[model samples]
Target: MGGGSFIEEVRMLGQGSTSSSWKWWAVIGGLVALPMCLCAFCMVSGLGVALLGTVGLMAGEVRPAREVAEQFLSALRDERWEDAYARCAPSFQGQLGGPEELARRHGGDRRPVEWSFSRWSVEVKNGVRQAHLEGTLTTASGEKYAFSIELRTRAVGSGEAWEIHAFTMD
Candidate 1:
């Protein structure tokens, strides 16, 4: 039986059966590639949308979460409470305390005269954009505080809108 099976396989190969035809392979390849191509297309399109949403386009220009964090930090450092609060997500604005309370907490002795931001990194995780910035906060009296900050952002609308979720400092 073993010898007969090996001989039958060789005979089929020599006979050039339909299974070995180029047309058959092409049809099989096309069928397999159809779903594969569709899946790739879906992934690419989804990634593109996520990127756009994360970067946030305005007036045909990109405004990334890092810039948002930069602006917020600058406002806080300058004691511009209203401006800083304006950039915060509504949910965050009224969370632990009011904007005025935040201003008092950060604006008093904690406020730095100027900041030096370095090692800026931006990444997106599960549709949330996280901006990591590390640097020094210098006070008017020449006091420097090394600090690390993370600014989070998330898409809110149909892949076209975004908001600053929150931020943490260390």
Candidate 2:
């Protein structure tokens, strides 16, 4: 009877070992596959974001010059002096002194409230392409003024970017 019981125990141990081996294989497979799955998901997500960004850019006017002009006016309207200054050409920056001076000069009663471009023209001056935009703006006191803005292409970090070359309000 004791011998029979010992044999039965050995058979049970062999069955348990087979099942444990299957469990170990499942764990190893999952460990190997999880990182690959994660990498694939990340790659897909990154591509999707880039595609959406490209679509968003394509949906716009695609004119860097007009975009910069709009950005400059929007910055001024929002009283974001530094942002407006950043969109200016180096020569214009020299003329405006600095962001602090820009704020000091345009702040308060002189600040523009609302503005829009009515006409656009392009020309080449000194071998540099420039965009001219004519617009109208209303001051804080409700005085309407006509304005013109010039944007020129400038070398910026190995890429050409449009910068505000001149802005005149009449």
Candidate 3:
């Protein structure tokens, strides 16, 4: 009679029946599983978005050096010796005396000459910039010469300012 009274109390509380007990277990299981599923989904989606953003940024940032290289070649082609020399490193200018001296030493232009640039590439590393230029230089004597030149520059002070550090012909 005592155990029978406890069983009656459980039935009245709605936990003694099989269907009600199973319903409570299902609710607890769903509460535990939902958060884990949502967390895994967010992690996978965030990684995908980050990867795409990085690739886009890298492509957008690569054009500045190419533009600089083109401007440099154009100056040389137009026989703008002063402008071309201005693009050289200040240290080189001081060592060689001046741009005019540098031209006299390396310009190789006894008379009017024609020049064209080809096969150019520019690279930037650790705040230093380098450019490779390959082209043909035709003297007034009608002699066609092929040359490869490397130019190095560095960022000066703050902002986007750059200064040439060296120019070499090979």
TM values, all candidates: 0.51, 0.60, 0.44
For candidate 3, write residues 16-118 as lDDT tens digits: 5656665555656778889988998899899889988976765444345435545554555555767766765677668767756755755555322666666
**Model 1: per-residue Cα lDDT over 82-165, one tens digit each:** 888877777777762666976776776677677766666666688766666677777556667777655666555755333445
Minimum summed lDDT over a 10-residue window in model 2 is located at: 7-16
RMSD of each candidate relative to the true structure: 11.9, 12.4, 11.6
Q: What TM-score would candidate 1 get against the native?
A: 0.51
The most accurate candidate by lDDT is: 2
Among these predicted structures, which one has the highest TM-score? Answer: 2
Model 3 clash tally? Answer: 1
For model 3, give the 10-residue run with minimal summed lDDT: 161-170
Off-target runs (Cα >4 Å) in candidate 3 are 1-81, 106-112, 156-158, 161-170
